[model samples]
Target: MKGPLFYAKILLFGEYGIIKDSKGLAIPYNSYQGALKMSENPSDVAKKSNQNLLKYYKYLSDLKTDLVHFRLDELKRDIDGGMYFDSSIPQGYGVGSSGALVASIYDKYADDKITVLENLTRDKLLNLKHIFSLMESFFHGKSSGLDPLNSYLSLPILINSKDHVEPTGIPSQKQGKGAVFLLDSEITGETEPMVNIFMNKMKNEGFRRMLNEDFAKYTDACIDDFLHGNVKSLFGNVKNLSKVVLSNFKPMIPMAFHQIWQQGIETNAYYLKLCGSGGGGYILGFTEDYEKAKDLLKNYKLELVYRF
Candidate 1:
């Protein structure tokens, strides 16, 4: 059986800041997507996937009483028929693999949940975020729910405040030399431990100061410049953002890229930051000259995301 499709997401700005109510922007990335389907194949991976879905289903079912409710019968029917996610999105790469699955489940199973076709108002969007947060917490231990929310809606969401968010527009791509890219870590990353490190770091007064001043400053600017299509300013802010991430979020950086991350700051060839929680996964990169950046990072796999 075919189910609703969920897209991958990118948190173009506000990785950690959004937790503190800093300005944030997330866009649906269609390059990777997932959907639920019934499979007759009984491969080990398929069996594991099915088992994972059963766990998530149980989690959702248990939380349905006070949170968003789903049509359990329909979900069970599909599950019994070997329903599993057929997706290209890589797991543990910070690209929303699990988030897409969570979104698809909610879209297909949730009764009276917000529909994508409905005119999404502030209240509905907030409710959706809340429900998706509870639903996704089963995976992440704790969740902001923005990833799954973005996956489900397939729209650009701008976080104005903790309680305020709405659909936003980003500048269309152009054939400029500057670009954003993803660097593969060749290993999977987990989200919870990385998040724990960030939380612990927040306990430091100095970290908090830098977060409020330097980190927030650049994060806010990046969001503004990106939304306004101010490419030049976006690059400048992204540079600072990259620097801050490198210095402060060191543990998140893959050891192999540590030198490259510093080299970019020193030489201004490219800026690198975490794509997600960032123990392994993918590291996001920004560079004014894609060719030069590619050459400098030649040893690693790079995927072009956008051009300035």
Candidate 2:
């Protein structure tokens, strides 16, 4: 049996800024997706996936919460029946690979799951986020639940604050020259370490001030400008945000890309920011001209996401 598909997610803005109550935006990326299915002939890869699912099943079975319930017996049976998650979403790339898997499991096994077609009031949204956060925490020691929420809902989400989130409408992709793209870092990122660095930095008064005043300010501005389709203003804020990330989030940026990150700010070719924790994974890029950005960033693999 094959369950429904769940898509990957891209956090266009927010990243670390969201933890400090900065506004954030996330959108569904349909190019990569995942689903739960049973295989007649389990290959080594499929067997590994099944083994992992068995571990996840134990985690979910032991999960204690009234927020959601799962048909653990059925999930267990599926795991024993050579079931595996068949997905194309790359893990450790900050594209919500585990989020999609979490979404798929919830869709297929949850007894009273919140269906995506519902009206989704603010409270309902919060409940879903909380449940996803708990479920995804198995993958990451801690989670905000935004990734799984986006994958499950398959809608753009706007975070007004730490406690406030709502379904949002973003400007449709236009056939324009400006675009949002992803540059593969060719290295996996470890979220917990990067987050620990941020938390440790929070102890410094100067870093706290910059995060509150500079990072949050630009992040909020970028989200507002993006939702309002203010391309000119959005890029301006993205440039500033890029600068702030470079100056402050030095450890998150790979050592090799430090100069490249700075060059974007100076050249106006494109602005790059952390896609997620940013130790290494995908670096999000924004360009007023895709062709120009592509040529300038020719050595790396870039995936165009949205157009301005």
Candidate 3:
């Protein structure tokens, strides 16, 4: 038996800035997805997944929140029956791989689970995020819950602050020359270490100033420009955001790509920023001319996301 699939998600204009209550936007990525399944004869991979699920089941059973509840007995039954999560989403790639798993499990096992079909009011959205935050923390050690919220609803989410979230609509993709793409760094990024670094950096008042004044400003502008279809303004803000990230978020970026990241802004071929926690995985790129960016950055693998 298999359950409904949950797609991966991309945070288009939010990363470190969101932690400070900056406006953030996230969209579902249908290219990768996952679901819960049970097999009569489980493979080694499935057996491993089954074991992980049992541990996750125990974690859920210990959750103390009154916001949500799980059908723990049924979940335990399935875990005993070799139920496992089979997924195509790449882990540690910043594309919500674990988030999809969390969402799918919540979909099937949560008692009085929030249904996507219902009229999703603002309060309902925030409640869902709160629940997901608690549930997904088992994986990340700390979670904002935005990732699972986006995957569970399979809709674009706008994060106004830590406590305020809402469903949002982005401008339709256009058949034009500009595009957003993903550049594979080919190295896995650990969320905990990266977050730890950010926390340490937060101790510096100068870093805090840069984050609040420069990073947040540019990120907010980028989100507004993208949602409003202000192509020219979006690229402008993206360039600024890229520069800020390159200078301030150096540790999170893989060392090999530093020159390339600089070259993008210098030549206007593209603007690159962190897709998730940075350090490695996929780096998000925005280009006013996709063909030109492709030619200039021919040494790396690029996956097209959206076209302008």
What is the C-alpha lDDT profile of model 1 across 152-193, one tens digit per residue?
A: 989899998879989888889999898989899898999999
Clashing pairs in 2: none
Candidate with more favorable, higher TM-score: 1 or 2: 2
RMSD of each: 1.2, 0.9, 0.8
Lowest summed lDDT window (length 10), candidate 1: 60-69
Q: Which residues of candidate 1, in runs, are more than 4 Å off?
A: none
Name the TM-score of candidate 3: 0.98
TM-score to true structure, per model: 0.97, 0.98, 0.98
lDDT winner between candidates 1 and 3: 3
- Candidate 3 global CA lDDT score: 0.93
In model 2, state the lDDT of residue 57.
96
lDDT at 286, model 2: 97
**Candidate 2 accuracy as TM-score:** 0.98
Model 2 lDDT tens row, 237-287: 999999999999999999989998999999999999999788998999999
